[model samples]
Target: MPRLGLNPDHLALAGAELADESGFEAVTISRVARRVGVQPASLYSHVDGSADLRDRVAMLVLGEMADAATSAIAGRSGRDALGAFADSYRDYAHRHPGRYEASHRRTSPSPRTVDEGRRHSTLSAALLRGYAVPEPEHVHAIRLLGSTIHGFVTLEFTGGFAHSAPAAEVSWDRIVDALDHLLRTWPTSSTDV
Candidate 1:
């Protein structure tokens, strides 16, 4: 019989917490088992293996990030939407580093990837919508936003800019502001994304 109160979701949540404290690379079945006060073998009943657990963690993180992005950007549009969306993501990365890392590592989501993922993508795409980007340019805009946000977050996590001026928060705000301006003035192009 399965453990009534213990399952993939619980394990993933606990694992995410562990990731935040230690780092995403530190998350593993053994470490999570230790945190949950269960035998390593016991976790096998809930998760196929470390990979499966990681996938669950990624899904959970994505859901959370999607929610945060959606909530923060409500009643907003264009540059307003862009900054709000960026703030939501930056806040999530700061608060849940582990979950944020998990979110980036692609996991073949449990069927909802297409649906749930669309909503998440729309957060940025909607922001881009205000910019009047041409057909193909819109795609580039999306990739640009992803790269900028991820690159900044990754660097901040690794202490890349911890010793710099303007602080990480300030840099994030400025980056979003710049992206807003760039998108608004984006040139029409047919460069395939």
Candidate 2:
């Protein structure tokens, strides 16, 4: 029988906290069960396995990230919105390194996760709307923005910037400014001269 006062949500939450505290790779059914004061088998009642637990954590992190970005970008537009979105992403990654890493993991699609992903994509599309990026190039712009933010945050987290000359903050700002300019001046055609 399942433990009293234990449920999927509780297990998932515990798993997420474990991931945040000790990196996503450290999250496992045994660790989560231990955290929740239950036997490893007790966790099976709440989660399919470690993968399901991790997926739940990933969904949670993605939703949290979307919420942060939405709040940060509200009532803002253009470069202001861009900067706010990027800053929110970086801040979240720094504050929740393990959960942030979990957010990057690919998971099987479910209604909730699909909607969560849409919310993120919609937020990014809204940011691009301010720059008037064409429909045909939306995917390209989204990929570019995602790559830039992910690259920067991953590097910053891994001490890649520890040996750098100038401060990373200065470089982040410059990158945002450059991205904004690129979006604003994106070519309408690919025809060569």
Candidate 3:
């Protein structure tokens, strides 16, 4: 029987906290169960294994990020909207490095995972709408924005910019400005290849 108060969500939440505290790699079934003061076997009732636990953490992180982005971009548009969206991602990563790392974990697809994953894409598409990017080029724009934010956050979180001159914040602001400019002046293909 499942523990009286333990469920998948609870386990996942605890695992997420663990990830935030000790790094995503620390979020194992045994570790979570330990955090919950239960035997490792007790977690079987809530999660299939570590992978499932990690997936749940990923879903959780994605949902939190989507919420942050949504709230940040509300009542905003153009460069303002773009800056809010970009800052939302950077802020979330800074606030929750472990959860941010878990968000990048590989996972097998499921309905829940698929839906959660779409939230980011949907939010990004909405942000791009303000720039009036061509429908056919939306995919490229989304990829560009996603890669830029992800790349910056990953490098920043990993201390890639720690030893550099000029604080990371300066570069971040400049990059966001550049992105806004790029989106505003997105090039159109003159010839259909």
Candidate 4:
């Protein structure tokens, strides 16, 4: 029987906290069970194994990031929306490095996890609406937007910019401004280039 008062959420939360402190790689059923004061076998009732635990943590962080992005972009548009959206990712990565790392995990194909993943794309698409991007180019715009933000955030998080003169924040603002400009003046067709 499942342990009383010990649910999947509890386990996932424990896993997330462990990940936050020790790094995502440190999260394992045995380690989590030790952190939560339970035998490793007890976790089997809540998670399949290490992969499931990682996926749970990934889903949790993704949901948090999506919610933060949603709130950050609310009542905003265009460059404002773009900056706010980008800031949300940067802030979350800075605040929760371990959980942020887990967010990149190849999550299982559970419907809930899949839906949670879609929230990011939906949020990006909504933000894109403020720009003058053509409908046909929305996919490319979304890919570009996600790649730029993710790349910068990952680099900044991993100390890739530690040796730079201008702080990462300076470059971040410039990148966002450049993106806003690009989106505003998006080429409608290759012939226009």
What is the lDDT, from 0 to 100, of the residue 108 in candidate 4?
A: 80
| lDDT (10s digit) by residue, model 1, range 44-114 | 99999988888878888888999998888888888788888887888899898877988888777567666
Instruction: List clashing residue pairs in candidate 1.
Output: none
Model 2 TM-score (2 dp): 0.94
Top of the candidates by TM-score = 3
- Rank by lDDT, descending? 3, 2, 4, 1
Clashes of each: 0, 0, 0, 0
Q: Which lDDT tens digits does candidate 3 get at residues 39-79?
A: 99999988899999999999989999999999999999999
List, residue by residue over 1-193, the lDDT tens digit for candidate 2. 8889998777777877888899899889999988988789988888899999888889888989999999999999999999999999999998888989999999878998899999888999999999999977887898999999999999998899989778899999999999999999977767533
Candidate 4 lDDT score relative to the true structure: 0.90
- Candidate 4, 53-167: lDDT as tens digits: 8888899989999999999999999999999999999899889989989988988898988799899989988988899677778888999988998898888877999997899
Q: Which ten residues in a row have the lowest lDDT in candidate 3?
A: 184-193
Per-candidate local distance difference test? 0.83, 0.91, 0.92, 0.90
Distance from true position, residue 5, model 4, in Å?
1.9
Estimate the lDDT of model 1.
Answer: 0.83
lDDT of 2: 0.91
Ten contiguous residues with the weakest lDDT in model 2: 184-193
